[model samples]
Every structure is written in C-alpha cells, then in structure tokens.
Target: MNKLPPDPAPATRLDRSQRSGPTIRDVARAAGVSIGTVSKALNNAGTLKQETRERVAEAARALGFRPNDLAQALHRGQSFTVGLISNDSFGRFTMPILEGLESVLHDERIAVFMCNATDDPEREREHLEQLMGKRVDGLVFTARRADRRPSVGVNLGDLPTVFVFSQSDDPRSFCLLPDDEGGAYLGARHLVATGGRRIAHVTGPERFEAVRLRRDGYRRALAEAGLDWRDDFFLPGEWSEQWGRQAVDILFSSTAAAPDSILAGNDQIARGILDALRDRGLNVPGQVGVVGFDNWGVMVEAARPRLTSIDMNLSTLGQEAGRRILRMIGGEHFSGVERLPCTLMVRESCGAQAKTLFQEARST
Candidate 1:
C-alpha cells in the first residue's frame, strides 16, 4: 500500500563495475565512436581516418581489448593452422626436430596441430584426413621410416605439404632431409685421418633413403682412399644398442679382423658399442675408435669415453622444412627434395681430428 515512497526516485545511478570483461562495444563507447567505426579503426581499414584509428586503438588498450584469433581467421578465410604428423612413439631423437620446427612455425603466427602415426598406415591416413577437414593451411610429416607416402584423405590438390628428416618419392610432395652422405663422409674421413683403419659399420635398415646415402658416403670415403669396401665390414642390423653390443661380440669371437674403427647408425648404437668395448676391457679411441650420428647431447656428454659423432642437425632440418612450407604456401617454386647440411662433433671416441674436418668442411 505504501508503494515504497514512490521508489525513492528510482535511485538515479549507473553501475560502472557491472560489466564483466571489456568488449568492442565498451571500447567504442569509451572512444566516443560507433561500433562500425571502432571495428574499421582496429582492423586498419583504409576507410577510417588515421586520427580515428589512433583513438580507437587507445580506447582498446585502455579497455584491454584483444582480437580473437579464431574469429579473425574465419573472417580472413584462413585457418592459420598447420598439421604435423610424426611417428607414434616419443623417441628421444624426434624431440629436437619437433622443437626446431615449432620455433620457426610459431614465428609465422601459425598454429600447429600434431599427431603421431605410430608407423601405422591406416592411422596416419585417418589423422591426415582429420587435419585436412580442419582446414589447416599447411602440413608437415616426420616419419619413422624414411620411405613414407603422404596423404590427406583427398587429392591434396594445392595444399602445402613438407617432410622433414624423412623422404618420399611422391613427385607432389616436398621433402627436407639431412645430408646423410655428407655427414657420413665427414665421420669416415675423420676416422681415417685419426689413423684409424680396418673401419667397419654398424647400421640401421639399408632400405631407408637416408641410411642408403650414409652407406654410399662410407663407400665413397673408402674409394677416395683407394681402399676396398669389403662386404664383411658392413654390418646390417637394427638401430639399437643391442646391435652395437652384439657386433662387438661377433667381431671379437671370430678370427675376422677386429676393426680399429667403427661407424654406428646413431648415438644409441654408439652407446651400445661403447658398453661392449668397456665390457671387453678395451679403451675407446685407444684400442678402437667409434663414430655415430645424431649428435645426441645426453649420451655424448655423459659418455664415459666421450663418443665422437656426426650431428645431422635435426633442428635445422625442421626449421628449413617450416620455411620451405611457408614459401610453398606463398606460391613460390621450390625443389621437391631439399638437403640440409650436417656437421661432425669430434670427441675422445673417434679422437680429436674431428675439429679439423669440421673446419675444412665449413671452408669448402
């Protein structure tokens, strides 16, 4: 009945703190402009005057307004996204390669969506299709096996795709690979210079393109030295420590000449070789010299005898892959197969001549 004394004139007051977060509308209001004007100014549309753009930007900064990437991408008809495919396992080798790729891709304001294929053809195909469905602007592949075919569940028509640390003969695909031949040549030459002979090799699958290149490098070095590459000196095996360790046993048990030098497929394999050498009471670089690939820091640093190894520079491979894919997206013509240079890090295992070879390689 009292009517609350006419509602006390409705308490004529505005709640400045009522809004949750800053919005474009709030920015427009603060800048004393219309919503369309604010949008045009923020987007740097030429239709807006410079003074209006400045005022709108100032208002946005004051209100802490930010543009949404997804919305902006939608408006621009671009996803600003890249899809990365790799092996299924979290192998130590792939991490550095991924980091390198990520660093370069992030600089270009591109988002990367990655998946592991687990070396399964079907799973890889499925993930590829999903990424394509999401409209990624580009695609990257890091396969466990060097020989891998690419796919996107579609023709991939004009989509940009690149492979890193792997290879594909598909004429349509771009591949960035380490100079395996060059790296192997450097390692073998280092061993030969360090007064190491009776050189032998413990290697991964020869079917892989990179592996074959490395083998060719080994042969080339031997040929350059006017030495015969004996089939017995080349050991085909898995890229594992067990293979290296067992190789030592095989070499020691047989009357066959023990290699004064050995080239391993990777750091892990090198570690195996070292373990077997130590077990047999042999000193690295003294009784036997060893060289490996994939200059893995953890093993090389903690190596008891300090293993000498060639670095494929997987990170550089990744960065180049990213750059090439970007260029491809920009409609630039590129070599379908790009080879990245690698380096050798000399240490106690293969003896100290590695530094000299590295220097000479750089000069050449």
Candidate 2:
C-alpha cells in the first residue's frame, strides 16, 4: 500500500503534430488579455496600465513567447536595416567611417550590412543588386580617398542614400566631406606661429583635388601671415616616402634658402622626411620643424619625434552622415555637400612651444 502511493496523474502534453511551443495567443490566454494587448505589452508600444503590462510580461515569460522579427517588421513597415557600400577594399578609411556609423546606429537599434566593391564596377553592381534584393532601408557610400567619384550605376529609387568621404555627380545628393583646405591652413599656421618663416609644402600630384585644395589653404595661411609667396616653395610629385626624400634632397641642392619648416602631404611622406633629416644630422624641431597631413596614427606615432599633423575628423564625418541619412529616412529633405572641419594634432615634431600652445588650448 505504501509503495502504491496512489497512481500519479497523467502529465499534460502538447500535440507534437502541430506547431510547437507557445504563441502570442497562448500568452494572451494565460494573461487573460487580448492578443493585441499582449503584443503592445511585449513591444513596449501603446498606452497600457502598469498592472496589465506586468501581467502580460509575466505571462510571456512563463509561456516563453518570443516575437518574430520578420512579422514585426512587416507590421511596422520598416526593416530597420541599412547597407554600407565602399570601394575601399583595404578598409583603411572605410573601417573608421563604419565604426562611426555603427556607434550612432546602435542606440537606434538599427542593423547594418556591409559590402566591398574593391573598386570594381561589376562587383559594385552585384553587391548593390544583392542589397536591394534584401530590401535594406537605406544606403551609405564611401571610398578610400575623399574625392569625387563616378556613379555606382545603381538605380536607387526613393532610397535614402548618403555619401561620405566622396561625392556623387548628382547635384541633389547628400555628400559629406572633410575640409581639406581648413586642415592645411591649420598646419601651415601652426608652423608659422612657431617662427618658421621659410616654409615649404611637399605634396602629392596636383591632379588630386585634395592636393590642390590643401595647397590653396597653405598659400592662404602664408599670405595671412604676411610671408612672401614663392612658386618654387610648392613641390608636387607622387605621394610616397621616396618622393619625400627626393624632395628634401632637391630643396637642399637648389640655391633657394633651405626651408625652416616642411609641411608633408601625408604621414608616409612625413616619415620619409624625418628619416632623411635624421640621416643628414639635422635636429627636428630645432633645425627644421615638420608637420604632416592625414594624422595617421601608425606613421605619426612611429616617427622619431611623434609627427604633428592634421586630422580629417573622419569619425565625425561619418556621424554627421549617419544623422543626415536618418533624417532623410524619416522623410526630411537634405541636399548639397556638407564640409566638416579638421583639427591639428600637435606633437613633438611641431616643436615644444607649439605643443604647449595646443595643450593649453585643448585644456581650455
């Protein structure tokens, strides 16, 4: 009789032949509320009494109900996803822009899909089509350099698109670019402030728009400082370390007075100049102050004296683009190219006095 202990009641079981587990209906039934109420409670939508929301939430937990994302998206009429297309296969510039976009998008609970076209029109077309097929809510286009590029040839009808670090030929498109002219002006002014009167600008080919804009900015700063402008002071060549070294050699060989300060086009060129200066037993900052563009951390930090350079504020550019795209997606209109400002990163290469000034200004 003790062993018998009464026959145990049969356990309740779900029908295995049908869909398994609890649905929204199950949660509603358990909570003694309507299905719509359960949905609003679970999604934190609509106005509901606290008691009812708590009851529905508890019931959902007890029944283990999970809402289907696709179904929810269909109900809301928005996928909450975006696509990022870039021709920068190496990801040097693209990564930072993506980071900035993600940082802003994360708070909004949006998702991003990324594709690299590798500077190939065919690949770009394929990726664009794939993204369109997936029904991305919006698109962001970017490139390795901040330049004007031809269209990607995708018919983006009514899709909210923003271009970053590049420009589209379309006049009505929203494009965000760094202010290269402002950045160059900052670098040149810093050198002049530190008592560098005879300044030289060694930069990449003149064919690049960035080079031309930066050179213009450099001249503007020198003119503002009342320094004499010399045509021989500007050296345009390839954007490489070898070019930097050769430019230095050529400058010294010429009868023109040796430049007191050298403004390099990019960090690579700056590094090369630093090396050449060291080999010639010239003291950086003391003998010849140096500044560079791009403020690329890898080359700047690795230089003997950390290189002072101009930062394009690419992350901020991406953030601005993100905000603009979000507004456009929300039916707000925006057009024309927006130019973001740049800042000079003062380091040892610019001389101690300049670094001190930069630090003081930053602190204030």
Candidate 3:
C-alpha cells in the first residue's frame, strides 16, 4: 500500500520548444494578442485600447522582456552612436576630451565608439570606414597636437563631424582648440610679476605650430612689460625632459646674464629644468622661477617644489565640441575654428606666494 501510488509526471514541465527565454511572440501569446499588437503596445507607437496596452505591458514584465535597442534605432533611422577618432594613442590629450564629450552626450542617451589611429592615416581611414558602416550619427576627430591636419581620406559625406585639438584641411569644417598664445602670455606675465626680469623660453621644435604660437605669446608678454627680447633667450628643441636639461645648460653657457625665469613647453620639460636647477643648487622661486604648460598632474606634482603651469582646459574644449556636434546633427550648422581660453594654475614653482611665505618665516 505504501509503494502503490507513484508520483505522476509534473504538468508544469516545459517542452523542448518552450525552453528558451520569452520573446515578443511569447508575450503576445501570454497576453492573448497578435505579435504586431504586442509590439505597438510595448513601444507605445500605434494607438491601442488602454486595456490591451496594460495587458501587453504586464505580460512583458512577467516575462522579463526588453526591447532590442539596435532594432529600435534602426526603425527610427538614427543609430544614436558617435565615433571618436584620435591620433593620441597615449591619451595625453584625447582622454580628457573624451571624458568631456562622454559626459555631455551621455545625458542625451548617445553612445561613443573610440578609435586610436596612432597617427597613421591608413588606420584612421579604416576606422572611419568601419564607423560609417556601423551607421554612426556623427564623429569627433582629435589629435595629440592641435595643428591643421590633412584629410583622413574619408569624405564624411553628410555626417556631422567635429574636430578637437586638431583641424581639418577643409576650411568649412568646425574645430575647437586651446588658446596657446593666451596660455603663454599668462605664464610669462606671472613669471615677470614674480620678479623674473631675465626670462627665457624653452620649448619644442620650431616646426610645431604650438612652438611658434607660444613663442609669439612669450615675446608679446615681454614686449608689454618693456623687457627686451634677446636672441640667446629662446631655446627651441625636442619635447623631452632631456632637451629641457640641455637647453638650460646651453643657455647658461652661452650667456653672461642667466635667465631668472624659464617657461617650459610642457610639464616634462619643466621637470627636467627643475632637475638641472637642483643639481646646480639654485633654489627654485628664490633664484629662478619656472612655469610649465599642459599642467599635467603627474609631472607637475612629482617635482620637488611642485610646478606652476598653464591649464589648457582640454576638457572644456571637448565639451564644446560635443555640444557643437549635437547642434550639427540637429540641423544647425557652424564652421571655422573656436579657441577656448586657458587658466593659470598657481603652485610652488613660480613663487607667486613665495614672497609672503619668506616674509612670514623671517617674522616667525
């Protein structure tokens, strides 16, 4: 009697065909409606009875069904995706720009596809083609250097495009760049104000547009302050720490009056100058002041006395580019280059507050 009644097979067991997760058809079946009706109800597209819409929604919730974004985008004729092409493989400049762009576009539910071209024209062309094939709504082009660059071989057609830290060969294309000249002036003026009369400029190669622009700014600042420009005061070389060190050596060797202040091209070069100064036992901001560009946190903070540098506001440039691209996509057009202003980040290197510290120390 105990073993007499074996349990019957469970009636709730799904068949092989029904083992998969729910689909629109399953939702429709569960809601006692057609697939088309279920789609319209779920998407809230076509008009439907209130009761039917509620029923479809409930069925979808019970089934844990989510609409396919790809399909929805295709139906709407917009991918809602943007491509970011960068030649800055190291991400020294591009990363901040990308962060700003992403921050702005994320609020609008837009996605970004980033591609590093590594300064290779062919690879850039390939990425552009692939993004085009993916039906990206727009593109943002950026580079490590903010110079006018040649076409990447893609026509770009009607796709909205924005250039950041770079420019297109076509004059009609829109671009965003930092005010390098302004940044240089700020650094030079700061040094001069802090009692650095005999100022020197140590920078990258003369071929770079940045070098020329910054030099011009430095000269303008000196002229405005009534400081005479000397041929031996400018040292143009590589964008390296070693170059900075060497430039300092050559500067002191070639001149009877040494520079009381040095304006470096970037943080790295500034660090190099600091090293040379330390080796010579010259006190930073006491005997000489230093100013660097880019305000790269890593290099600036690592220096013994810290660095005072120009902040290019790269993220701001990126945000502006993002806004402009969205506008372009929205049928509003803009052309020509736009330059964002740079801000001075005061720190120990330039000695803006050193005089007060010295006076306080003496009093104490």
Scored by TM-score, the top model is 3
TM-score of each: 0.84, 0.83, 0.88
**Counting only residues 3 or more apart in sequence or on different chains, how many pairs clash (N, Cα, C under 3 Å) in candidate 2?**
0
> What C-alpha lDDT do the candidate models reach, one value each?
0.79, 0.85, 0.87
Cα distance off (Å), candidate 3, residue 293? 0.2
Name the lDDT of candidate 2: 0.85
lDDT by residue (tens digit), candidate 2, 102-196: 88887788888999888899998999999887677789999987778888798999899999998888887889988888888888888998889
- Residues forming the 10-long window of minimal summed lDDT in candidate 1: 355-364
Q: Write the per-residue lDDT of candidate 3 for residues 1-364, one digit (tens) a residue.
A: 4676878877897876677567889899999999999988976789899999999999999999877666766767778899999999899999999999998999889999999998888999999999988888899999999989997787888799999999988988988988888888888988888898999999999898889988988988899899999888998899999998998888778539999999998888999999999988899988999999998989988887989888888999888988988898899988898788887888899888632321100000
The list of candidate 2 runs beyond 4 A from truth reads 1-68, 358-364
What is the C-alpha local distance difference test score of candidate 3?
0.87
After superposition on all C-alphas, the RMSD of every candidate to the true structure, in Å, is 7.6, 8.2, 8.3
Model 1 score (lDDT): 0.79
Tens digit per residue, CA lDDT, model 1, 1-364: 5555544466555666554468778998999999888877876665877888999999999889987655555666667888988883865546677788788889988878988888787888898888888778888888655565644445676788887766665776778877788888888887888887788888887877667878888878887777779887888788889998988887778787778899888888899999999999998888899998888898887887887888877888778777887887888756477677778888888866434555212212
- Best candidate, lDDT: 3
Residue 203 miss distance in model 3 (angstroms): 0.3
